[model samples]
Target: MTSTATSVIPSTSEWTPGDVEQAKEAREKLDIWPLDEYNCKLLNEVHPRNYVTNADEKEGSLVYDLIAIGAGAGGLVSSKQSARRGAKSAMITERLAGGDCLNVGCVPSKALIRSARAVSQVRRAAEFGVIVSGEVKVDFEAVMARLRRLRATIAPADGHPGTEEAGTHVYQGRGRLTGPNTVEVNGKTLKFKKCVLAMGGRPNIPSSIEGLMDAPFTTNENLFNLQVLPPRMVILGAGVVALEMAQSFALLGSQVTVVNRSSKLFESKQGDDEAAIILQNQLEKDGVTFLSSSTVQKVETINPGDGDKKLPLMKVTISDKVLECECLLVAAGRAANVENCGLEAANVDYELGKGVKVNDYAQSVSNPSVYAVGDCCAGVPRLTHMSGEMAKLVVQNSLANDQWKLSSLVVPAVAYTEPEYATVGIASEEQAKKQGVECDVYKASLEHNDRAILESSNIGFVKILVKKDTDEILGATIVAERAGEMINEVSLAMKNNLGLYAIGRNIHSYPTTGEAVMGCGVQYINKHLPRLD
Candidate 1:
């Protein structure tokens, strides 16, 4: 609730009307919303109001070899890559430098999830024959504080200082495309030979839901600012963020309900219905209630005179039921942050829901000198690592004249819920069938794994789809503890065209959870390969 201006910059300059407006603009650029010590420290690192760049001094003479808009993972990587390669690169963003993943999406959420996991682990210690003597308690404030502290600790690497140190000029302002080769930011015009649109996405708050805009609901962007855990919480949408947060809060002692429009969870993407069911069952076991085929009809917030001192109780009316809670989180979906960046001026083709149109090379279809990456690119997977990969691709193609492709890259994704759901390439057998590929599914149930059985954490499976009669890995879906880490082995295999035969040949250590991944390969080998006995 504090103002960033006082702590971020001491206002040594005269407070003229224009100066006040500039200060406001700077605050809006980062949009941290919560001006707490941690957020302010983050602002000081990423978008300090007092920080001035070469663009402000030599606007006309400062023509960069490459100018990347948006300082998220993609922007930072793209501009830094170019800069490191001896290109005069400059990056402009209307928000914090580290982008969504570092600031809100991945970093804070994972920290909070880790805290939640600790709580769950302590509660379930007796199941593992390690009984605790006392009551398990969660300090919600400390959890949030830890998230902020970690975020601020990790900020310097992607902040303006780090970016500039990497040899890319950093500008904190709304970057608008003035021409194919020019970008305008805070009255500073930066000319560039190549432009990269890495302006990430925002949470999609559906306007169709009545009273939702008026209610004090939280999105991923500002969810970390909570001072206390809600006793009762209602989450909208059954996507990755919704399910992840629902389970986390439930583990932390919130009566949580997840409302989704689909008849089942994870029906939209990741096509692994069986794997989705396993994850949903695990979440339900963790005290999360699911309302499938439901939509929020209305939302109402009751302040009870506490104002900013307390979180208002939210009355969310959904299909066939009315729910009340201290917290309402909207995780419906995400929309690209493609507005107000002057895409038209740059002749960039973009859609409101989708993002900037680009070819397989990540170059703009209409303007070859212009490119797009990360969540800002239409139809690309919205993952932090994918953004980084695309950013690297943009740098290679823009600078080195390489034709490294976006389609060629196999992207992996994971929902950091307990028994994490991880998938890559083709997600399920159904998806492979839909694409008319002849496939066979090989599954290794974790209940049979020695490591999982010993840990009393055997509740999921590792399922892989391969081309029929061959070892070609089409896709994989893993639902297990450390599934996120285990899925990388499959991703590497798919990326290199290595088949199940290769995976079967590799030696996995005895009685490990990763044996399940290797077990899938063994199953494929046993069924397909002939024995020379």
Candidate 2:
């Protein structure tokens, strides 16, 4: 069978900055991505080959030096590296041309958050002596349209290199391991010297709720794809995505009600419990409703055809009372996408929930010839960027090349909310104490930072944990503006074997969240001084 697919043009090459700005103005009037015809052309250019069809049954058995499954962050990086190293390779995936980060994960959500942040700025504009005339209304449809256009615009970078994309041969289908060192794609047998499994994962929906299946619910994967914003909404989890999404949809004009199974809003008592409480209190004042220590008994849809139109009339029963809303978003958790992948056929070792078993090199235990990376492989932390890094180590070891030191990697985790939280290493003091490590913590609140005060958004803190007798940095946490970018210093320190004192000596720019790291550095360093007699 021939693969006939539509191609997408990159918006950056065709739509210049001037064009983008003009399109924004045109959007005010047209309420769409400039013009429909032009947008379609742009989409086709970027995604030149449509990823709609599954692999056809090709009778030929193609053997390769390396094979990669999945085309997300991990798979793409591994495929590119392996090809560069002279390993004849192939990469397979079953999603849109653009992976989760582009289509449904980070990119789209962040674009939507940009609009949310702008709305938040207007709400707080009174503090800046900027008076508004009428209540700042939200054009939900227009906002969503902008996000879609941006996705269509940015998608080509990941999808197309105008053919001959400089990587492994790409396949459009799900891959299943039919034997050791072999996988089946599109009914074709593929033999490999070695293979890497980067199958990634999916969002989880709580099962305890009896009628939830019948209820209208959306996960992170499908939330941003909604055509209309709900008038009232309920979220079932208190994790990072739930909190960030709650703030986002709330800023974008949704009456958000959060029901968390845990008692605390974020359960963020890792360093300064006071700051977490402050944020929870502030969130309450901003009109976001919250309920803690509650479990969903069941999910019940009010009407069958309620969502016949884009906007739906929906209701859920929580707390023994029917919680009426237009939609329900489940940010409960994530599950590894390992089903029907033929892991059982190859006797690949895996846990039902934790994912495929792997070692420092991201190698699978069941088959020595196979390895795994990203969300599909177990790690101390699971993040897209980290997955890309892990893939590099696996690829290097697979190619027998010398590069990344698998043991010396220091990874950081960031939660992208208005007041972000970034962390690396250990934070659970209780866990540390039980581990028999002598630890002390130093903290600096954002309220004291000049930059945070200047921005009028001082709402976080930074904490440093070190071994009591030594200056070695054990772990650190930052809950502040741009904590995602600010957490790098701590991560570097951990990776390079540097202490908090060295981080304190390094000068940082003024009026920035990064300065908080410097402040934390000084605090931790000062604690190491010789005691007075």
Candidate 3:
């Protein structure tokens, strides 16, 4: 295997002793471990050193059958599937192998949300016919600590050790395409017969707002690391992430204000206006403020000065009014991490703002040997579960002679708020109407559900759309406490060509939120049946 000596940065004239120690610790963390029994066992049939060696050693020879670029859910799944099929595989990553889902996005956010939910439940204990204590206080520090601990426990499953255990070589470095069949990571170049890019994405910070970069702000990347809750927080972009955190933080004792350019909160395409209004009303009741059709014109930091130790405050100008807060969060959107990956050098067609161009099989349109998935790919839904589905398709297409495509997959998406919102298949009723297809929409409010009423969490509804004459299930939207979990049944029905009649005929256990789906189906069937004279 090839090895290179680590270079030490020349000491600056104004360097401090603490800086030196920090650098030393960082270097120690980056040290490569020698292959031992554990490493050997993890690597299994493949030698680990082969992946770290110079490209010359494997030149003209395929080092692996499949090489996944990013070690997120998509890349990890691709590698594991390839290895299970007896194809040599390796995964290269720039950051933690688990990518954002394990590190920053899903795992951490959900942990915080769970903690926030506990607080909300305790505060509303009286509503459930239970007596409460003197006051419900949120220990913000302890809450954050619990989130960190949980993340650490779940991290190893997506770390280097986990990837190695899955029989894939793990390379920790920025992987760039040097050739059509070759990737360069760290100082080593590896050749592969097939490659999949799953490099994921990052939070998109808008550049239109002046002084936004200079001001103290947080994104999903560092938001979970906050130890103490800010007294007041201003969030830009009333998207899924912003709304979720706004409610969470406000419930956790922060005065939260959401400012958005659009008059409506959620997007019109995937989200229902009625659902958005309900969610907005719920959030407002919980002490969160919304500034709709507003833009942050400028941000100015106010310092106490005079050697004051207080945290600086921010004065934000939104439209004609000014809002001051201690913290600002930018949840505008996500941008694909397609740059600096040598896509141009490899002739992979991609666009700025948009991601890599791919075909039905997840294969790059420009280079058939290479494929892209997850947020890095263009035109695919930017959801973790969707990425996993794309990964499976890429693996099947790569390993087997017969290729499977992603076109037929029924994907479900969820936004994890207090009353979660989930949708599957075609969610828009208006779009169905615009297409000239006669469809029926059936809805059931959670207020009528036994489980929701018992739990005092009756806040949302379930709406299902189906073909008018045939009773075929077309799309569904569930807005409730466990909408994320409840939407799966609808997705399954659509996948298997099940109709509303089947759902209505099936028995749903009494006193559960899931019964709402069955209730919607029953309503549809009752409405469509021949009228009694």
Candidate 4:
């Protein structure tokens, strides 16, 4: 490993008592750690002189040029790119080897979702012209075990920290800033020329809800860990987290009740008004209850009847009514991991909830040398895939002869509910006013789509926004089965500056949800009379 120090600063060059004192003095002056009061303790015992000394007897440590705190999607991409771009870097995080995705987030959640979906399909196999089974049963524990094993198998490729390069290092510890350009990891001080805070965020459960803290509740991180499915579950949010898990659990055989402080579950998507009614109506038919516009006042846990292994039941009081559930899954929201990073002292400019502010380049507003991304540093959407792109922007802007910027790309956010919600680009009305860009919106109901008719996913639609004067596409939203896949075409249109005319001319496959894209384009073409015509 090649260790290089900054040329802007002078090194003592020798390991005499005076040099040791000088090193300690410099660390204290920079507030970089190994302070004078603890210098002897760290040098003689904690770190040890031989531990840091070189083969030629030069007492030195690897001073990385860049340090990335967190090994999640954002951190790994940033570190790898930084190393490849010829910068000395290191990544630090506090988890069981992998970050949330491989250990708990995407890997476990999606695996369980797919497993639940399998059970759901099998239960309805008789509808598909197959009649067999003495009552459909679920061996949820075995399913969970399989999910855990699969997560372990896939950890190395997606979760393993650090790259194979010589200059980059990965360590397992919670990194905290002790100086503007310095970080201390479990007492080991790592100094770097630049820093990137990719540590992401944690679930934000409100404190005003009284006994929620003392109660045995589950977050997205712990919800999928349950080997035995709960008999009843009360989810407390209307956001993506709450909605996704609510659908997953309900399908997995749990009696689910979604209590949102709003009347509708998904109000963000345009035309979701009708779809929300349809979803609630369908889920209610399948034993899912909706306690809309309700607030979870408090919760108290009672012993479970199953056994010691089974989790205790939670009794939640919403408004003036009392409701009981075998488990309470809290997916309220998420907060940035920015508390102890010394942003105020570092003069890092940030918004109330957006995190370390960045323009198109993903550079920190407070310090151009520093950058942030991921859940903590939200870009267009706070998705793992989007954060990976943001980290790429940081890497490109920081080094090499690259001129690409990430803001130019289109990002899509997917809420993995039963009928997944996926959207991209500007809202029709908002775009019209925001840029004074005249636009016409064309919406095609899935009720008319042959694919939707076959799949029973006719409750959604594909909405398109086009520039009224020029027919240039502005945005699109799809709320249907495989909406995540369908939203990409709209994103591609916005990315390539494609117009409604081009989309209308493009032939879409029949008996598919994406045909709605061409349908919308045709509708837009029909709405306006061409000047040539």
Candidate 5:
């Protein structure tokens, strides 16, 4: 697992006078920290002088209390928590510190989604009795500019300075495990008592598609880099990223088409078909075309020949049909960054397509001294919050004596679509039945919700599954405008082992989306009430 190529970090010695002035101007314009040559050198240094003590004084060994690989949410949290508890911690990262969530995944996508939602709301302003106005248009450049501005502003918090300020030694290089407790970075060996791997994941590209490798395309990593919106966009895959981007781009005036090999949009195991249909229908209404049970056989980029300024077009083949678009976005899935990281050298068990093998406690099964979290951990949910939760558990297990196991049941997942879908605990009723658990289901439609009625957004429902003859809430799902925010209440209930009765007894704010959760709970409780004489 040795790295064939070493990471190269920009140095201050290479910067010219113009480079510094340009960086200063960009920083002032975006209100972001200047990534000048000095800052770049500082962030990319292999080891800072202040942190690494003389190895000769300590018997020729540079030992740290904890070592965290990857600077994403999990690694950041692990290092911070360890340092806060008086442990000498070190974190190593080869790329940007925040990983996918801040750089390419959550933050940028949400920013674009918010801009798209604004366009939708403006288009529907007539429903709110607003006066007649001119046609609404999306300033694509402005939207992207704002996204860049926001990302730059938030970047410093996850940069080297932020982690160093938290009392953790920050190392900027690719970290490879030279031994079970030794990490080698930039020709320097860092021995640690405990280590946590949070290398995260990258967008998975399908190699089977003909000409796809040579075709110009955008994944989540570079989607926000677009300065001008494509007139037509073809997206591969119908998972969360594809669907979310499809809706957003369609709303922002792109003629978007989504191609999927499966007949269904979301995976059947984790997603409800009914909920998928509801979201699909909404996206279709917004001018997004979906080709289910279809796959992209090949792609060819051709010059439109309209003018010099015309962007190149992508010709995609799906079965007997051919679709052309200005851009192609591959959102099939994600691959864990487990390669060339010395997992084999460390004797950590890992699968090729999957990730590092770990138990419920996130500890490496083959090596007790090592732990893996986030997208790099096989069988764990690859969500930002889930990574943060695993970080806490890793910190507890690494530093404290407490041995806490990671629980997937209490973790909630949300797809941030227009009418968001959220679920927690055991979502599949058949799985519960297979486990010999009898469940009672209670449902409430958003159509009956007062807030939904007022907003004319009564298109989803809240469903709760309770153990039959008991108040135990096995699972809950919410489909509404604010499902992401509403699902937290159910997650909190599950975490505290509270029953549906407790949720029902609790009062929610009037005329709010949260009432739907309370209503489902009340429905369950009332359905089981005993008959009186």
Candidate 6:
């Protein structure tokens, strides 16, 4: 998307010499790794070293209608949504406004994954009766550069300029709750009628692993800064990030190995083991390796000297296996960014790993005036869209008397692997059974799909769970090239409380991947409905 960075620049009369000096200091203090041109440009658009706070520009004490403590997906949306409702909203962030998704998680990773997919497609061109090709190569530097470029290009929408343009006061500094209705940021005591805690989460590194802190390792936060692709790479954890990166790097020509603590993949509480195994199998065919039911015992840096140069390689010991790699990526999990935020002072309750405790209304259990959203909120799905949805709920519940419940929302998640794995609602038969709901699973294999067969891309299936003896949809899991897109229909069906029969009645176009979704519906109709064929 195009940025409005130029259009939102503050005029000369609005800023004094003191503000300019503070902006200069802010730029110098900002510590974005590899502070290259692209990153610097991104910083300028989001946090903006020259940004002058709205509080400083206006005279007298100002009390905001809403103050959001982060500028991530949740915070950005919360502040913007509140402002759109004609509330005097203010947002405070210690780092970039767009938070993890824009800077590190989704945007950059997808760019790299798309590039890797292109490489895989080219290598498999002969399968489509296309030959006569030289060595298919990958320029790792160019790939990373493109990723950074894309992030910078899209940063404005979630940055200082775009937020300010949307009528939300953007403050670039750490924000801490000092009281029930006040937050302190950069020596400014900002009072608010209500607050949104959206600091989000960060990549969790296992502290139990010996020598991990001192070892040569990287997280998603800094993984995109690499200019050179390591010849050998090892990843910790088996979640979406770990598996996705493992496959992407493998396709990019790196010898990639993934170490997982559990025997099964996608072992998270909301994970689907069947779908994960399908994706894992495809990753294996692409040259990625997996060491399951394992844990990293120790991590150390060992330099195997070559002449005058001393190149350090990471030595990792997992169970009985020992592996050495030029790079070690830690995708263990996410920990809430709750430290130093003064939750206690704000009468807010929070856990260490899980985030700010909130009720079904997304309001703090301890302080009703304060609400939390995104990864920072405990017991909520840590997805970008989920966060935005929660932010909207927070905006409505806080400002109006709306009783929007978080539990009522149906969430869908996707793991962006080659044959993408997407899941929603109840997840599995066991989960449905435990919830005391009997379910009948309707599955349609892509092998039988006409479009899948024509493209030779038939590797996975679409499986949906419906209430036993009824068409009431409970959940779904899809593993296909476009599973991410296909799962949306199931999510919509469940959200609207529509039965499987409704999907069966709808006409799907001939020869399409989405036919898999319709096929599941067709199965349910054929089993229950009277013969009309």
Tell me, by TM-score, which candidate is best: 1
| Residue range 1-533, candidate 2, lDDT tens digits | 11222232222323333355645633442223333443444334433323332212244425667788887778877776777776666777665444567667888788888898899889888999999778899888778778878877776666635322554566666789998878887776788888888888888767778878766677776676566778898888877778778888888888998888777754643433554565566567666788888866766676554332365556677776668777788887777878889998877888865789877667777787888887777654567787788878888888884545556778888777777777788754654775788887778888888988988878888888888866688887788878888888888888889988888889998767788888877876676668899
> Which is the winner by lDDT between candidate 1 and candidate 4?
1
lDDT string, candidate 5, 482-516, tens digits: 99999898888888889999999998989897898
Of the candidates numbered 1 and 3, which has the greater TM-score value? Answer: 1
Q: 213-265 in candidate 4: lDDT tens per residue?
A: 98878777666556578888898887777766777778778998888888785
Compare candidates 2 and 6 on TM-score and give the better one. 6
Q: What residue runs in model 4 are displaced by over 4 Å at the alpha carbon?
A: 1-61, 96-98, 165-167, 268-271, 304-308, 351-354, 378-380, 401-407, 427-438, 528-533
Q: After superposition, how far is residue 246 of candidate 4 from its true place, in Å?
A: 0.9
TM-score of each: 0.93, 0.87, 0.88, 0.82, 0.89, 0.92
Note the clash tally of each candidate: 0, 15, 0, 2, 0, 0
In candidate 6, how many Å is residue 455 off? 1.8
What lDDT does the true structure give each of the candidates?
0.84, 0.71, 0.78, 0.68, 0.80, 0.84
Scored against the true structure, residue 119 in model 6 reaches a CA lDDT of: 95
Over all chains combined, what TM-score does candidate 3 have?
A: 0.88
Error of 5 at 5 (Å): 32
**Which runs in model 2 stand beyond 4 Å of their true positions?**
1-61, 160-164, 266-272, 304-309, 401-407, 529-533
* lDDT (tens digit, per residue) of candidate 1 on 1-533: 11111112222222222244644553455445345567667777776765566333433446877889989889999988898888878888777788889888899999999999998899888887898989998988888888988998999889776777677777777899998888898897778889999999999999988899988888998787677788899999998999899999999999999998998877887368887888888899999999988889999877532323387887899987999998889998899989988889989899897999999999999999999998989989988998999999999999889999998999889988989999988888778877888888889999889999998789899998888888899889999899999999999999999998789879999889999999988887788767789
Whole-model alpha-carbon lDDT for candidate 3: 0.78
